[model samples]
Target: MDPNEPIESADSTPESTTNKPQVPPIPTDGTPKKKYVRAVGPNLKKLLYVVFALLALLGANSGYLASIIAMQWYTGETFENFFYFCMFLGHVALGLLLIVPFIVFGVIHMRNAAGRRNRRAVNVGYALFAVSVAVLISGLLLVRAGGFDLKAPTVRSTVYWIHVACPLVAGWLYWLHRLAGPRIKWKVGISYGTVVGATIVGMV
Candidate 1:
């Protein structure tokens, strides 16, 4: 209150004047802070289920053709018909429709599993994916070599065996993959039913 004794301004007090606890500046380097998102959304999971179901159908058809029909009756007409069937079922239909989505979503799922430290799932998923890719490539090679009408007998035989073998391996890996992940009982049932039905239809 003494005029000669200068009163401290309210704002000049240490508490009032103290700088706010500075927020640490976000790092400007290109490395972004890791952010975890939901690995598979509900919609994506459903789509993956559909993809898996179609894969089951294709697997059944191919398995039936190779094991029961092709091995038993390797006739020219049968081979030609099977080749056309594959072209329609595999190359034209499911391959064109679902292959990209399957690969993309499968990789994403695997990466998410890896991030979540689900090592077994990641490993099995990767193995399944690799085998599936091998099967696809070998099938293409087999077709290119004239399917059952093999022009290059050696190459066709080798590719034929590889195409056949990879799927059998993939079937096992697929089951393992299913075991490792959460089970959708209904989807599994439907897939199995589809496989059985497709196999029966293939027989006819």
Candidate 2:
């Protein structure tokens, strides 16, 4: 009310002027924030088991076919019925149906590894996936090139060899990947045993 006195603003109170903790401003941009949800441990384990089982079956079938081919080449013994049955099982049943789930689960496993920030696992998983994909494509190409026929000219083609070599490389990579993880000694023994067992089973 005094004519010369300074007028106090309503917002100039001590409470208003007191320093409070500054709250971060909420982002207003339209971009959605990324949330890294970890994959479920049990579910991931199940997925891995499924993937490995499928791989084993597929690998065994391929090995059987390869062994038959090698025997025919080395000893001149033909296994037409066995070869046809294996071709049907491997190409039609496993290749068409099981491969889809194999790739899906494999990708899921790789992504899970990436989410866990396991650099080595992610790298190895991705490498294996890529090589497996290459193997699948080459196998399909081999089939198209008449490699399915024992006497077909395409049996001797580069594509057939590529299909063969890709699987060998993939098997090597798989063993390496397994051995690089925990229980190195156990994995090494298992890897060797698996190779030997598969080879023997195929030969028989």
Can you give the TM-score per candidate against the true fold?
0.62, 0.60
Residue-wise lDDT of candidate 1 within 1-204, one digit each (tens)?
Answer: 677997778667575447667679889897988887666878778878888777766755555555545644765344446655754456436544556777778777776667767678668888998988887667655554334545777978898788768877987897787786667487767878776776656765
TM-score of 2: 0.60
lDDT of 2 at 182: 54
Model 1 scores worst on lDDT over the 10 consecutive residues at 141-150
The runs of at least 3 residues in candidate 1 whose Cα sits more than 4 Å from the true structure, single-residue gaps closed, are: 1-36, 67-71, 74-92, 145-150, 184-191, 194-203
* Residue-level lDDT tens digits of model 2 in 1-204: 898998879868676557776788788997777786554366777866776676666666666676667878999988658655766466546665566766777777666567555567667767877888887776665554444544556654776677668777887777677765655466755785698576757555
Q: What's the true lDDT of residue 179 in model 1?
A: 81
TM-score of 1: 0.62
Candidates in order have lDDT scores of: 0.70, 0.67
Clashing pairs in 1: none
